[model samples]
Target: MATYDPFRDLDRLASSFLDTRRGPRRMPMDLYRDGDHYVLTADLPGIDPGSVDIDVDGQLLTIRAERTLSAGDGVKWITREREAASFLRQLNLGQGIDTERISASYDNGVLSVTIPVSEKAKPRKIAVSTASDSQVVQAHESGADEPQPIEQ
Candidate 1:
């Protein structure tokens, strides 16, 4: 025999009223730098691939998606927990990012974006030269590139 719990029913009612999802929701994502580019992955389960929209405006990146539940004309929901919802997320891309080369793909309910780093932002080594040991010492002492010899 199942016992009736008034407190449990009250808690369920309160949760139903408070947990109703309306408007756009935020999706969880992960971003990390891989080699010369950044990879961003977001979870978007139960979303149609065609419904996923990604946009890059200036330095801002925005992702939007919609999830819809099927409801037939004669169907009645005995316990409806999942509802139709829209998901949105935006990120600010800083300098050194190659926005023009940004690419994205969706597979297995996961969205991935690749942001390449600009060539100018890459690390490089500079070559150093010295005219002579004496010149180097004199230049350092005089705080100049080359020390002029005394005219006799």
Candidate 2:
């Protein structure tokens, strides 16, 4: 009897199956955080900017695009293939998200989104005092007479 490793077989099977499924493959995206903002970038070529819509409903961010094409009326036989597809991507943003400050822009087949963190989530710099005017006072113990003014 032999034990099976799910990961070993899972990768091989999933890769082959996904490879066979063609037509407008789901694009890959990169997410990174800098300072107090998080950025999400995705590649969506051959898609019109007018047809793309980005929205954040609750904590989920969704992007959808629709495309259409037309041919002449003189065609005898038709072999039509759909060039448009509804791509739904939902991201569950954890706590500390500033939903009101979310913004998105699409240009040159790329979509960029900047999500600002809540006010409390942003880092703040504390001011440090460097002046020598501040002084520290010491207290004397019960028996220790308030140290009389040092002898001149």
Candidate 3:
């Protein structure tokens, strides 16, 4: 026997009503930096690959997808929890992100976007020179060394 939870049902009803009023719902996503690039993954189960659209406009990235359900002829619907709907999400990618090189792929109902960091923004190590090299650089920078005063 299943226990009845009135509060849970009420909450679900309220959520569904609010979602209907809000139009397309925002899909959940996860973003993280990996090495020289950032990866963003969004959940889009039951969404057709051809229906997915991704756009980047002036540092703003947007993702949209649609989900549709079809009922066969002479089929009666009993309880329908999943309905035709749309999902949308947008993110503002700040500076240092190579927007021109951004790429996206979808597999197994998950959408992944790879955003590479610009070359200028990548961390690089400066070569350390030997003491002799440092002295040469110092001499060149000073043009000519002045004679030091001899202490008595």
Candidate 4:
């Protein structure tokens, strides 16, 4: 014996209309820096890999995907919940990013993007010339956190 709640139906209807698959939806994602590259992973379940599109325009990175529900010959949906829709996400990559080498891959419904920092942007050691001679000290940029001796 299943009971139907009118309030639940009303709420569902309201959300469905507000959702309006015609409009773009947001994709859940996580971004973090790993070594010299940044990794961004996003969830895109029930979406075709072919429908996924990623592009970089100037400093902006854009992602778009579309999801569609297939209904075959005289098929009826008992309770249609998942709405067919489009997803869009964009981020301003800003400067110091090596946009030319940016790459992305989709696996198991997760979209992963690898963004590498420009060579000049990477932290490097600068050789400090000393008047006293033989030993070499290292000078790093202000934000490098440590100033250690250069290894041979």
Q: Pick the candidate with the highest lDDT.
A: 4
Highest TM-score: which candidate?
Answer: 4
- TM-score of candidate 2 versus the correct structure, residues matched by position: 0.59
Clashes of 2: 0
User: Is 1 or 3 the stronger prediction by lDDT?
Assistant: 1
Alpha-carbon RMSD to native, per candidate: 7.9, 10.7, 6.8, 12.1
Candidate 2 has its poorest 10 consecutive residues by lDDT at 79-88
Between candidates 1 and 4, the one scoring higher on lDDT is 4
Model 1 weakest lDDT span, ten residues long: 132-141
Off by over 4 Å in 1: 1-13, 132-152
Position 107, candidate 3: lDDT: 98
Clashes per model (N, Cα, C within 3 A): 0, 0, 0, 0
Better of 3 and 4 by TM-score: 4
lDDT of 1: 0.88
Cα displacement (angstroms), candidate 1, residue 107, comes to 1.3
lDDT of 3 by residue, 70-138 (tens): 889999888788878889998999899899999999999999999999999999999998655533222
Model 4 C-alpha RMSD vs. true structure (Å) is: 12.1
Q: lDDT per prediction?
A: 0.88, 0.76, 0.87, 0.92
Report the Cα lDDT for residue 87, model 1: 99
Estimate, for each residue in 1-115, the C-alpha lDDT of model 4 and write its tens digit.
Answer: 9897889979978997786457899999999999999999999999999999999999999999999988889987797878788999999998899999999999999999999
Question: What tens-digit string does per-residue lDDT give for candidate 2 at 24-142?
Answer: 34556889998899999888776778877888888888777755566568876554434455554668888889999999888887888898999987878997886555665566667
Pairs that clash in candidate 1: none
